[model samples]
Target: MNATAGHDAYANSLCRQRVAALLRVPILAVALGACSGPGADPSAAPESTAYSRPRPVTLVGYDDDAMEPFLTRDGRVLLFNNSNDPAAQTDLHWAERVDDTTFAWRGRLQGVNTDSLEGVPSTDNQGQLYFVSPREYASTRATVYRGRLHDGRVESLQRLDSLASSGLAMVVFDAEVSADGQWLALSEGRFVGAGAPITADLLIARRQGAEFQRLPASSHWLAAINTGALEYAACWSNDRRTLLFTRAGDSSNGGAPSIWITHRGSDDQPFQPPLRLSRLDGFVEAPALSPDERLLYYHRRDGQRWRIYVAER
Candidate 1:
């Protein structure tokens, strides 16, 4: 291989290793757009121009380092992890939303969460549960899991063997599946070292048959969303035309992970440049919207620990 290509290869290899090591840690917080085929309905979002200031979420029956809160399309079910602490062997948990900002913890999700890292819970209307876990991280490395979520139990758990696989060694730490189950937005990053910590971007995959696959056409639109920064925790709006993700340490947020958003007129168009959610700030990541798009939910660092918070329109 040429010298430049060889150097690039070496860096990629190191990236995978450091990323794996850091995957279990709580510090490094962790996709872009759908291509043609999905239709758009601008009416999904009301005439609200801004979201409310971030506030602590009153999570009943649970209080720990919350991360990656995925609310179902009906805004009834909530799936998340109790803590990001690897020492705790974090597992996915479920809850039922009692109101806009309160969720009553149901308990641990059976059949999933093992004695390893498991969080970043996501699901679609079809009851397919998707999450990231190091349960098999030693063999799979960068992995995203797929399973059936039913009756508060997860079954037939399996890694996304290909589409959201760590093909390039970049881990699929966070994911968001549209309610319609047509599009999956993944936020990925590779840890180079402590100095740099992480370099991440977003990627979108289209659903084909029973599986999800990357659309080559995503390259054009993804550019507008990636932006060469630590972008992760992708959330798709009800219409699938609007996307919200967290940008870690952008110029606007002073190196803190803050929420940002981008939108397209339709599925055929590329996304516009992302704008930071100026009203929301601080070490916050994982942007999730309510079914009606009236409320936005995310997790933020509260002192030394983390907690889930929300912002309403």
Candidate 2:
């Protein structure tokens, strides 16, 4: 099936599942597995023995699916986005664990405005959400917004309007909030031409009262490489000292992007030189560090499609 048709089919299936759940009916044909494609290797070594080998975790399928998944404090709930959704226009979606490795599709989390295009979901220790939205108030461009979750429901979303200004020209893809909720790290960039060039750089914003202000470029350790055209998808360590990001400089390098890590005194300080994490020739992007900082979860492209992989520290 074509991409659009596949997405529609998946959506219809999910809708059916929702209906079944509402009617207290149990249907037995739910296949939970990663979609097959060039980059998706069914034989890749499993990351952990704690989990079953060759078990497929559903990230996205059918439609041009890109998910930014993050675990909550308890690690039972997963929050992400389904870009192919036709109704909400690429809105945030959530899933909760039904068993050890199985998650039931809980409907879209409440609180996001249906009129907005929301993606890239991240959470802090306090359950506050930070995501990107192309809503009207955000000047019709991708801007970062935050909302607090109370009792599994979201409150009103508040945009970081100052970052959406013309001079900033930054499109934030992902953000990470510190455990204390005082520091925020984001992958953002300024547009150089009409097309969206992968020029995003890692930026740090500090919470000042009720607002966040961007820190100067010179303040971070990776400041030297925070240039116009070679970075995206940044994540922070639990302690907020180390940062992991993706770098795409030369198109001919490989199929997957490279992952880099940096260290700084604090969020306001400069980052050190970045070191490449994966030596594999494939493309690696969307690096998420485990809470203990011992393992890394990222998607690597083998050919046309991207597959999730876990790397041990």
Candidate 3:
């Protein structure tokens, strides 16, 4: 290989090694006081839970890929993506909880699902929806969009210019808004080239009046969460103090990626180190907690299809 090609190969190999090393070290944390920023009160951090064994959730009845599970603040509604028919367009769907363990399908989301793609739906207390989709079919990256949920339908779809104008060429995916709509957490995939692989990192955006602005990457808890690993699909607890997300795990243990959870003293405080949910093994994604924070919802690949699973105390 030429000199440039040789350097690229060497860089990729180093990245792979770092990811493997990170996977071996189950719980990684930065210096205890490294994240003491404004509005941070170290003594107020929430109590951490001892990792528990979680069982599979059987309520979701999608024969296709049903991932990126998101629950509303009330926990009465569910939103996710479906791609059962590989030849057809991947779209978003919703369901209403019938009981603690059952849900009634509400069918495909209207006014949001387009011929291109739509996935990763989240909402605030006011029922405003946020999701990711391409600006156009030929577009290289996807952008985050905001819409209103009225009478069980999505309305008034519009692109969030503040985030879209962050001056990054990446595809935004899996997003969650805080209960009060003041904080936005999403993942972006930065690709190497046209046919090159993509690497993802989590980003937090704060709302300013009608627009949203991203936090400086340097001030973020990137070292603890990102860690040169593919991290995404993060959702906050009802109180916005706990965060659950997914990242690449050792393949021998289960799948390429696994579920993890972290805690913070408050919204202003950076996240404490994350701990992997060892019991929820295998190809898991879309890690989310119930509105009440008593249960967790996620999905794992089963055969050629993906199924939704949940865990409760």
Candidate 4:
């Protein structure tokens, strides 16, 4: 099947599973050990300068298909996106770290999860959530929504209208708000020219007073990192100077989208060219760094449903 058809089929399957779950059906989730275990390919390996080999995350209740893992500053809390049923709405979920190798699933984040698609959560130290949802936007677009996350629940949700008014085109998703809350970076999809192949690239916008203005990609310092291929789902390191995003590639040739990182010495310097996290195998994406930058959490799809994995830095 083509990509769209395959996606639809997957959505339908998940919808059925969700219905069964709601009805108290005793369907057993696929064993996590089937994907990664003591003797599995995804089991832990020796540390390297790059990412360590991934080990599957143990999730409770919802583990069949999960992606977009984000960890809090202290690495005590984890948030990710998962679709449990045919509603096909990817809602946010959270887990608390139980130890170095496991996180106990908490549950779907209440209130913040709507019938609309929501996931890819990023937050600041102050407990504000920045995520992408397609509910209220045009069918071909998704917008960044902000909310106050308090006491483990999302509340006071609203769109960041200032960035929406910046006049970009087509779809916007996977938004990452800077630590200081003064800048934004997100994936944007649009046609390069009339009849040209459509593409997705990362864009940056900075807060100017009460509004935001999209920085010109043509001359923006980050343009170099947003290359010919699609790139999105960015996360900042603890210091906010290093950026990690997903870069797509030809899967058949072993060039599937993987996590990549770029660095700048300071706020005033331009980002250097991005480098792939080559040590971790598989189609990796959605990178989240721990507060100390020693642990990395991401999702990887290697001939299986997406699963969350962690690696030592």
Candidate 5:
């Protein structure tokens, strides 16, 4: 089927599912009251249960092919990296959402010329693009680059050299933009030569007139544990008060990894102690929240491979 037709079909299917769910609410309520004991308050509201059945959202491509997906603000477009084609190297690609739960493959992004690896695409509130490239860096090192998309094309490619110096080997794996587009949360790691640190730490960079400046590390109880050495992926909450990040102990002895949450009053305030979200096992990375802030999507390594999973807040 053509792309447009496929998208229409997917949208219709989603609408039908929502209508069916709404129609069953009355019958479900009746069944619950009938099963309850006499004198029980049937009018009482039901407790909110955690989501168990995994509702898999469809993104175009094979399961093993796509990586590092960044959804647009409207959740209508997904930018990701795919290495499915044998002739072509890994490149940044985009997919358009047909409905709330379905996506169709679009095409390659236009006009950021470089043969080197390009992935980890981030979009600001206005759809400005920021991505990592190893093209011009010395010795295949990755650096952050930003550009503006205009008329279906990217213009004025510029590198963020003030963020780091040459040979520092900086990479921005994931970034989160605030609601007002004033602050940016990024997960950065500095790679030295061989025998470097095993993980990367989270950093907060605020938007100065036209550029960004990294904020100083906050003083929290957890920050005192190992102030200098802790690596994890972090994302800012919609209010920018809470930060969700993956925290792992030392990686040299195969330490356990889990998701943690830290709260702060504002972007400039200190953060509270971080608490673990899940039980210890496997490596958890890429913690992101749904638009409603009720669902979290993350990836965990099972055995030899990694799989995406979602949890309800």
Candidate 6:
């Protein structure tokens, strides 16, 4: 429409074309037709770019404050936080997925959520748990911690001190590890006046032995993901080639939070421009997908409380 907007759109198109040429692999089809073959999700539309309408999930025993749900690889288990309110009892809880819109509460995760703020539960297919905590209750050096989640317990608890917040004004808000344990994705936020993050960026780290380190090359690789917005909740797809993250829209423009997707052809290639997920709206964030990438999970504000919701192809 305007000169500036048109020029920006043209520049972005060229950038995507350049990356596509270097990758030499077919970019992910935005349509759901790829999954329309035999033994696929029959409910998936062969021609649509959107998913089914999201529905609120009922965590039977959990309170009216559930959010940030991480559905297990098998779609049987769910790990989430009750609430993040400082005045309330904030902790991580687990549930058994009873069906498409229901889960049986399994209670607080033992050994991890005691006397502190623990939230943002993320797990790879190997059952490794990655999450965030301010840890004001402990003399910890980091805000992110890792453990092995199994049978309603988090064992081998250890803070990833190496990836801790680098400054007093910043903290790791959300993070996840690759299924192969070779990569780590995190959202480090800088706080200003309010409690919410004033600025945030997604960073990628390469794993070496027991520790993960950020490299200079990751900035180039993730250049398209860490744009000029409130980006957080970084997640790696099952193949580790596709990335899912949330971009908070500007309150000035009446924009709401949106989940975006970007993909690379290989481990070394840069991600293409992020494409906002279709038909997802409202105050939704923390996008999580099943191992097959069929079911999408996120949380939305319902009046004064937050609740987990799921959308399927």
Error of 4 at 140 (Å): 11
- Candidate 4 overall Cα lDDT vs. reference? 0.63
**Number of the top candidate by TM-score?**
1
- Candidate 6 segments whose C-alpha is farther than 4 A from its true place: 1-50, 136-141, 192-198, 251-253
Q: If scored against the real structure, what TM-score would every candidate get?
A: 0.82, 0.68, 0.77, 0.76, 0.66, 0.79
For candidate 5, write residues 39-94 as lDDT tens digits: 11213212223323333456656455454556665565666665312123556677
lDDT of 1 at 250: 42
Clashes of each: 7, 15, 2, 3, 0, 0
Question: Model 1: residues >4 Å from true position, as ranges?
Answer: 1-22, 25-49, 164-168, 191-198
Off by over 4 Å in 4: 1-49, 83-87, 139-142, 165-169, 191-197, 208-211, 217-219, 250-253
Model 6, C-alpha of 305: deviation from truth (Å): 1.6
Q: Which residue pairs clash within candidate 3? A: 57-309, 57-310
Q: Rate the local accuracy (lDDT) of all candidates.
A: 0.68, 0.53, 0.62, 0.63, 0.50, 0.67
Give the per-residue lDDT of model 3 (tens digit) for 1-313: 1111212321132112222111111112222122111221224223334334555444455456676788787888888877423244668898888765567777888888876557778899989999876544123233678899865689988888677533233456557888888889877655343222245678888889977888885246655666545677888877877788876522322225667788788766778777777677666777777777778888777766767777774
Q: Lowest summed lDDT over 10 consecutive residues: which window, candidate 1?
A: 31-40
Can you write out model 2's per-residue Cα lDDT over 120-173, one digit (the tens) per residue? 567777778887654543333436788986545689778776555354234455
Q: Between 3 and 4, whose TM-score is larger?
A: 3
Clashing pairs in 6: none
Evaluated with lDDT, which candidate comes out highest? 1
**Cα lDDT tens digits for candidate 4, 73-178:** 5567888887433335578988888876688888888888877667788877777788877565543233778888765798888776655523323556668777
Q: lDDT per residue, candidate 6, 1-313, as tens digits?
A: 1111212211111112111111111233222121111221213212224456888888887676887788877678998988664445668899998887899998999989866568888876688888877664124437778899898999999877878666545556678777777788887755444232345678888878888887678889888767545677777887888887776633311244567778899888999877666566666678888777888888876677779888887
Candidate numbers sorted by TM-score from highest down: 1, 6, 3, 4, 2, 5
* Candidate 4 residue-pair clash tally: 3
For candidate 3, the 10 contiguous residues with the lowest summed lDDT are: 18-27
